[model samples]
Target: MKKIIFIICPFIGLYWLMSSCEDFLEVEAPNHIITSEVVFNNDETAIGALNGIYNQLYTSAFSSGWQDSVTALAGLSSDILEVIRSTNITLKEYDQNEINPNNTRNFNIWSSGYNIIYMTNSLLEGLANSNNVTDETRNRLEGEAKFIRAFTYFNLVNLYDDIPLLTSKDYRSNALAARNSSEEVYELIIRDLENSINLLGESYLDGERTRINNYTSMALLARVYLYRENWGYAESLSEKVIAQSGIYELLENLDEVFLANSKEAIWQISPAGRGTITSHTNEGSIFIINPIFASLSHFKLSTGFVNSFQEEDKRFQDWIRFHSGLSVYYPYKYKIRNSTESITEYSMVLRLAEQYLIRAEARVMQDNLIGAIDDIDKIRSRAGLELLAETNPGISKEALRETIMEERKRELFTEWGHRWMDLKRTGRAAELLGANNSLWQDTDILYPIPEEERMKNPNLTQNAGY
Candidate 1:
């Protein structure tokens, strides 16, 4: 894999040049290969610049939903997944919680995250300086850019504990920047999401769910608030998203939940962004173990994770598949392993089911046991399981909280780092993982800042365990 540059001048425009060599998109800006003046001069180029960010996301290591992405790496770090190949030492490090700061995958996650941040910062800067761009276009672009930045930082802070928060395109300052406290990062995340909500409209731009909208920001913000322990705000924000009944709903068929533009998706990344004729998502191609390519499969669900789900659970029946030849269970949420046809599935980022879980957890924190049960029941009902309201109506707060956490693990296994982050946020990681694995340590909660990053910036500090 290429070592992605952290600060590339005119990142988005360069992407535009690579994807579609439109001569009009070229601009004569010295020092910077592309400039805000030309890129944001009008709506067409400005939108293209934004699209560049979306397109690049499909290839970015941290967000790509591929083998090296957070979905795989973090899933390995948790108990939900195990690396199938012992020869793959890097992935095994993550699975065993013995990751080294010098690990290339760690570096890729760090660099790729900052690469996207640089694109967002550049977009925001370009929109701020352009006067010719329509107010509508400027506002929407700014909101989306900020949301992306916030989203990136949110993941960075959670993964590495303290990360440099770069909100501008100035490479000099960014190169020497020190890490910001997680609290400071969360403050910016909250502010950016708030601004995104105000600037973005309710409808998905151009009818594509891949584009950020007000509800998308709300869904992410709801998660942020839940992590920050702002229970009331988290509850209200998730409720706002869940209340959009016409636009979003829990799909009765578990198979339809991951399809492109599904009503359940709050935000999705289209594989079309990859600029390739191959339309299947990286998640599908890497995770599904086709018999002919079974030897190439790098990951499989852990035995404990597979056993955690009841035999009758619809999620187990629909979202997971067993390979009789290899005797392994793999994530089947994404059905297409390889395809040349038009895209059918997308890499899901934020979805409606998570909002219900967020709301349910938030309500549990606020002493709204009944309301929390109601929200949890929404997910259970869709899963073809007996509703909590009917099965255990008088459950206590402590037990209900545990139940919600279990539900989250069952419902959101391989999507993102939800299981890993959930264990950390709830302070259950050490207790749970330590009992099962002798190698588990309290300091393993946060991944180390990449050694390459520390070398680049002498001012940067390493996390304690590293």
Candidate 2:
């Protein structure tokens, strides 16, 4: 019996009829019209299936439901964000450290992430048995699918701790599987990333920033290593990416970092249309508030985060914007909220600045203080601030470690839940979050498994706090 599955299908009969050159369809094609045999046998159809995942990523309920992404959810759970004194229960719950298992945002992120993973697994299974595509296309497509799966699982493991690992589209197996240990999840993530690095080419596909390349996989691996405290491997991997100086450079202008086609971006999500005003799908649209369009300003930068930056830091000067009348500040890294005529920025997922921080943290863990300080300085100098050693000559390794952590807080705030995860990874979440919110407890680190998922799958277990 065919088990009921919920992922949106990206292949349609109309998809096969349309020219492959007609890029960026706004909606997913119906699932019934195409089968795995057809998608895997025809390169155009397979490409459509892959591109459909990207389209779904941009507008998927998980990515932008309630105009909230994991970034927002995680930020609110940390010290970097607070609700805008509004009656929005969801926003308040996250800020108050009172997440309900039934929270819509949590459900969307969990379901959406698994949905994308299932689609990728389906494509991978089809690709493995097919012979229609050329070797180059097969390798690229396989590598890309694995990369997406690894990325999705990375988010899942960190957020849920031990989630069911899905690598196939078999509903009987996938639907009833129990959560894998976090260590097991990491092992699978490492294996998938290793496969991705081996299979992906050095070149970006179709000259687009949206696709993950070989280095993109490496960058994410370095991050994974950092999180797992695999210092030597993480440092080496991050160094390899930083060595690609010709292809990737840290832009001197902070303003240009988030712009479309920015040199710093390793992977970004393309918006649905060309315009200065952000589409509703763009994550920036949720943060940007304008009377003309009346976009939601669900959360604001926490005073703790806003005041963390040094007075002379260029990020403080350029990337943080405030409304004088409202006396509230929002992240200005994504400059275009509404479109004027042409698209100006894409939602940045992976970038060079983070690689530096990853290497720095890894280096510090390995006792390579000099190398770590250099990496930190690269970000500092770019941010129009003095180098660490310059500012504090003969700073001890302990001091330098704290400095790097603070730099990450200042640089990566409001971007992703980098701050939230960073705190959790360093085992500082309880101290920091507890101080920020009296309601916070140590178990708050792991979000509860969504109530609906738990009810549907006997294997699912709720986190302790919830």
Candidate 3:
């Protein structure tokens, strides 16, 4: 009964998707819905409004969904992926359903990501209406809200370039919203993130383990810099995050990183108490855990990647998927899927491992090989592998760069749709994926605009090649 009210109260069952008031779409009415009394009419209510945004972390948009990561099941389905998988290079298992989508052709991730934007706008609108919020408090809340907006938009523009830019509240109908250029979107992202740097507080608490604070903000900025190819800023911000007096550490065993520990969690989205959705399948699991891809032994570890790890490395144990007495290097970072019954585990969004990675990459770009090696060595030490000497590595710089990136793929595989995105960003997707020229087309990089959005707005245009 309560759930029904919660759902219905937020919707007239109509997301008008219009320009006037449709820029934002939040499912929940602010506390003032029943009465014009502002929820932020007081300090407690204002705090709750802030917390509401944090709670969005557990939503299906960021949690267990095909868009989230289950698309790992599609490797076998794509002809392009098969070539890589047959060798130790690919471990795809969910090919049959990888490109599948709803009748609308939009994965739940499409809607979920937009919903986050809507909810964020709702919070921002609420803050604007509140009189009791002090300027100091208001700025902090505003900073965090903008951070989320930028973060969400970063994924949106990256996944669907030319996405509509909505900075206001007016979404109630299917209004026409022209797709903004990818470059423009990236500019706004950098601007928003930079503004957030000074606004968000130094500490925010949510029960115990996970919450966003100054460190989380810094970590996010580092990533944005790297994404924008700003090596100096990326390196500087990463160092600031690391020098925060050891706020995070690498988990002792590589396999244990996915088990919900927070010792080195710079920022993580916990999966406790999240709702369930039907999982879309993947290539590795279907091959190793299901019978559909039985013809080929489950995809084996790639030689390039395998040679990178030392025999003593602890993460190797986590990477190997043992089935029917055969052990292959599979994606070992996601541990919440073992249960056949429910998708009930926390999915980490940010961590110290990535911070170290960004720093290493930036250092290498800066020709600071010693610094880069030190960062990589710290990561290697945590994985129980022999650290590289600071003085000289036999490998060339390009090879070393590849080594650092591959480590990220190995360590963070199957989380946040990273495998696909990382490959695309690194320009390695074409070489790695099967023989399809379509894989490299700009249109395929971003999912096509939901057809309905195009139909509603006269100004809207389909991405080239869609």
Candidate 4:
């Protein structure tokens, strides 16, 4: 086996120094490249390697929640967001679902996701070969690395149906790797999450919710099962996470949900990970329209989407903001646009609200109508809407399922491409988006595998209708 060489950079280790987390900051200066042998020789450096992955997530184009991130790109691909500037050809492709194989932004989303996967693979190999680290440290690092890998693969598979599943850091082999079936990719995702759950402890390491824990793995795994339509496991896993009310809960005030370390967050990526003076999350910086710079803003909530919300829905009132100057409503889930103060909001990846919706859908699929309504009402109640149980206790299973889908759209919009992925997974992308988008095609559900990637590797093939 070949040793993985890591180019340790300032941003990778700067996360600890900036956050003042002493335990993971004792490594050497972050300027020089170091081999895996030295990185995994001690506890702190090995941990720093894992920390680097988390930090890079804030910088990675795919997960950063910025204009290039999934939240913005996929929101445009879906109906939730509209491109404020039609001149941006890259974004227009996503908005119209006519993305060219040569589009660089589409390639960026694809390559950036694989970059994180590479880091995770590197960390996993280093941890496996090292005997200098303690068992406790090794297990925790392994679990976190696997969880991140699984998370990245999940997004990639959804975006490009059959993707190159690179599990190891063998560049020679990986450079020429062919795309694997979605089933093959998902098999690895499920296996990784299950192993991660067993390897990790119940509590967040060092009391930081940003760190992956047993429940974090379970939360993601539950979602994976739900997407695969494994209803029993999805319901059971989500039920377990929801039961941990002491650690996680739905905040009564919707405004507090995205705050750093909020009880609502199951897992989050801190803006501190960017290692920049501008502490505001990318989501806020891109989506929130500043009057002075209103002309520069790129995206706004779609008019149809804004109208989809009921008049009394608190999410509509609390999470959406209107700009009279621009005459458009924008997503305000993350409030601070330009701030140099201490970090206040961490980008929400998984939360308690999604679990409730997941369980509701799973239950309805299992024909537990009454139980399903109870779960849906939890989200509806938080939004200050009439409880479904009271308003439509006798609703049929089909109607209840549609209600859950609508609720997910309203609740999870503009967050991690949930709306786009939901439409694809539920087989409704063509039916829903086609009605409005003239460019809609069933093949558009999967982005064209980047043309540049195919050029580099002859084995890599393009998706149909590209």
Q: Which regions of candidate 2 are displaced past 4 Å?
A: 1-33, 61-66, 273-281, 292-296
User: Which runs of model 4 end up more than 4 angstroms from their true locations?
Assistant: 1-6, 9-33
Q: For residues 1-466, what per-residue lDDT tens digits would candidate 2 score against the true structure?
A: 1122333233521112111101112224445544677666767767767777776676555454234577888888888888875689977888888889998777777877887787788789878878887788888888988988998889889988998887886656676778889999899899999999999978887778888899999999999999999999998998899899877899999998987768898888878522224453355666765646333467678887888888899999998888764678887777766664566787888889999999988888778888888899999999988887677767787888888989988888876588889999999998888975778788899988988777667777788978
Instruction: Please provide, for model 3 over 1-466, each residue's C-alpha lDDT reduced to its tens digit, 9 standing for 90 to 100.
Output: 0111112122121121212222223233334233214556655555565555555555434333322332332222222123223332223222321232221324444555666676567667777887887888788777877888887887777666678777765554324457778888878777777777787666656433455666777888898788777999999999988886545667775655544545566665544323234322222232233334444444434344555566766666665454443434444455543344443334566778889999998998888887888888888777776677643566567877887886776665444555566666776665655434433443344455655445445676766655
**Whole-model lDDT, candidate 2?**
0.77
Which ranges in model 3 have alpha carbons more than 4 Å from their true place? 1-37, 62-105, 172-174, 206-209, 259-261, 273-312, 325-330, 334-345, 390-394, 434-443
Give the TM-score comparing model 1 with the true structure, all chains together: 0.94
Shift of residue 97 alpha carbon in model 2, Å: 1.3
Whole-model Cα lDDT of every candidate shown, in order = 0.87, 0.77, 0.57, 0.87
Cα lDDT of candidate 3 equals: 0.57
Model 3: lDDT of residue 97 = 19
Ranking by lDDT: 4, 1, 2, 3
Q: For each candidate, what TM-score against the reference? A: 0.94, 0.91, 0.76, 0.94
lDDT tens digits by residue: candidate 1, 1-466: 1222222333443352221111111222235455679777788888878888888888888899987799999999888999888899999999989899999899888878888887888889888898989999889988998999999898889999888888887766777788898888999999999999999999997788999899999999999999999999999999999999989999999999999999999999999888789999999988899669687789999999999988878999999999887889999999999998989999999999999999999999999999999999988888888988988999999999999999999999998889999999999999887788898889999999888777657888999877
TM-score of 4: 0.94
Which pairs of residues clash in candidate 4, taking residues 3 or more apart in a chain or in different chains? Answer: none
